[model samples]
Target: MDRTESKHVFVIGLDDFNLAELQTVRNADEYEFHGLVDYDTMVHPPSYPMDAILAEARETLANAPAVDAIIGHWDFPTTSMLPILRREWGLPTPSLESVLYCENKYWNRLAGQEAVPECTPAFQGLDPYSDDPVGDLNMAYPFWLKPSVAFSSYLGFRIDDEQQYLQAMATIRDNIHVFAEPFDNILQYSANRAALPDHGSGATCIAEGLISGRLCTLEGYVHKGEVVVYAIVDSLRASNNVSFFSYQYPSHLPVGVRNRMISYADTILRHIGMDQSPFNMEFFWDEATDRLWLLEINPRISKSHCPIFQIATGASHHEVAIDIALGRKPNFPRNEGRFPIAGKFMPRVFGDTVVTRVPSREGIETLQKQHPELVVHVAVNEGDRLSTLRAQDSYSYEIADIFIGADSESALHDKFRHIMEVLDFRFSDVVPTNYN
Candidate 1:
């Protein structure tokens, strides 16, 4: 195809430069890719300038060639940025209100109640900044508390007592507005802007009665109002089961269970009217009660699961996001890829600690040479404090992300265990004065 005939897609927050895995959909010969804005400036604290980001994106898109689609995998600002850019460029995208309906935890809960009340949990929105934060709760203790619009589980905590509630509330009160302010900026462009609450003010939090069961994600897209689900990945947690340890594709859940979850997601999407967008819905299936609880829904692909899908499904789900944005059906392979199963594992340390040793480039290269298929991404470096890392959950520090493929789940676990032993990260056993 000639260059003029090529379709160009601009990713709002292309955090990393690596597009090797995603290019499986099409190389430069078929489509041109453009990246605008860094992830840090858009999602982090002290610099979430939503208006500036939007202005900069407009400038980039105007200068670039005719753009065909806009896509993103990260949450908050990136997913939030897509609709605005799509509107400016006249590309296919869900309405800003539809995207907000999915990203705002509190609003999502409200919609879920009407759409799939059976799957929606008991939830209430609270103002953590109030003197009586606990008094605002319609639900009891032992519930999860998180910002209405935050990413990567940052500032998310489990509220079990008055002290824990107070502590989590303090952190939330101080930081919730980091994402909230920028989030509120995007709402102004929404058609249903008047119907929403002030979630971008850092005062609101969602407290829900804890729901327990096997957790999995339903990944799919809605195109021209039709919702189609393609994959389910089982989320395996470590330690107390509150923090994620690994994500395994080709979930062990029965076909019937998977279909039911998909059906439930389809109903919810239809109700919310999320059209021309890729989405991932997290759910918990309580085997004892045989019930499925809708945890949350994001208006983008789960970037964490992309590589595993590429390893097991022969293509990255990026294909779906891009194709749907370009007004085409995803042409993923029906046959499985190189691995029957694959896992993305987060090697986590439970307490605050200082890194004493990290795998050298030489060590990582050696391991890759020994096992050509293994992928190692070290998040921490020597002399760095684990607590200072960005986007960590409250309970633990993830030192690295490791991806591997195996013939079976057990084999995948075994390979991950061996890989951890090989990397051999050493940490100083020190207690932090500000431990959450």
Candidate 2:
């Protein structure tokens, strides 16, 4: 289709991207851009409520013109609604059944075990009511308790002992709930997956945390059952903390290992029937086994790394993904060109809100002045109440994110540390009694 003749694209989640790129896409000329629908607006507290957002989404789409394509930037609701939108507009998409299976961890594990026998993780379904409610203890300690159909590490915990497991279960019970309402009746479609038992609640899924030495993610597009791996980003984390700190592109994996990781991803996508969408597949490298283990697969472009790819290669993954979703064969190259290692660092916070002083504007400005090439995106503002790292945390506490690019890994690391030192934002004051 000609550029002018192409239909307007409806972006579901606008809050996911960094400021610079978000502005670029909003103002780009390649396609007519329509207004965005804040999927999280209806949900209480403005976090993700999968079913409610999907219901509102169908109504929003009904009022808009027949969009050429529906893009899911980073939100879970956008990913879940792909099949429904395809069905509504008679656009090509993966089967709804396939999308459902992939979205739910309960089904993903069951299918992953059947399809890729070697790639499956050790997991068991927990009954809400049981004397031995913990279920099977097949895997070792330091296991992960996660919700079946969720993202952003929400409702997930690392259990180290019996006491910890009990505490974690209490936390899960207080937060999550299985949705019992009929989604089709309310939305005129089956947009709802498992419902939260109550408002602002979600379901839970637990698993034994794999002994992963390092985390790396692969971004790719699948067409006609064939997967084209675009970029592999190695995640950088703090030596002492479990939260992810940054990501460096042009991964330091051996050729054979990289190829193996791609092969594993292909197997999972094919088995899961994700034939017509973009994916961000995360994996952990086991040092002892020298093997790659599947963590989770996201059905959208991995945000915070768009600029990294743009700088590394002249191509944009966002544009490629949109093209593929619109049924246009993208011009992405098979052999990705290696470039300088880029890093994305998220600010760490200790409390719910920035009750105390946070990162300084001057410090950030100084970093930007010192390193003009770096692309930094700060999400936190003064007095903004930070949400929890994982969904299950009682109080939320993520402050900001910083993206930097450099010639080498060491250079990127040094630049990140220097910036953090300059923009020091941590909790030193006592928690306020009236903190809401």
**Clash-forming residue pairs, model 1:** none
lDDT of each: 0.81, 0.62
Score candidate 1 by lDDT.
0.81
Q: How accurate is candidate 2 locally (lDDT)?
A: 0.62
lDDT of 2 by residue, 242-313 (tens): 666677787887778778889888887887667778878777777678867777777777876777765566
Regions of candidate 2 where Cα sits further than 4 Å from its true position: 1-6, 16-28, 39-55, 128-132, 135-140, 178-204, 333-339, 349-355, 360-363, 379-397, 429-436
Model 2 scores worst on lDDT over the 10 consecutive residues at: 193-202
Candidate 1 lDDT over residue span 202-268, tens digit each:
3468888889899999888888888888888999987677778899988899888889999999898
Model 1 — TM-score against the truth?
A: 0.94
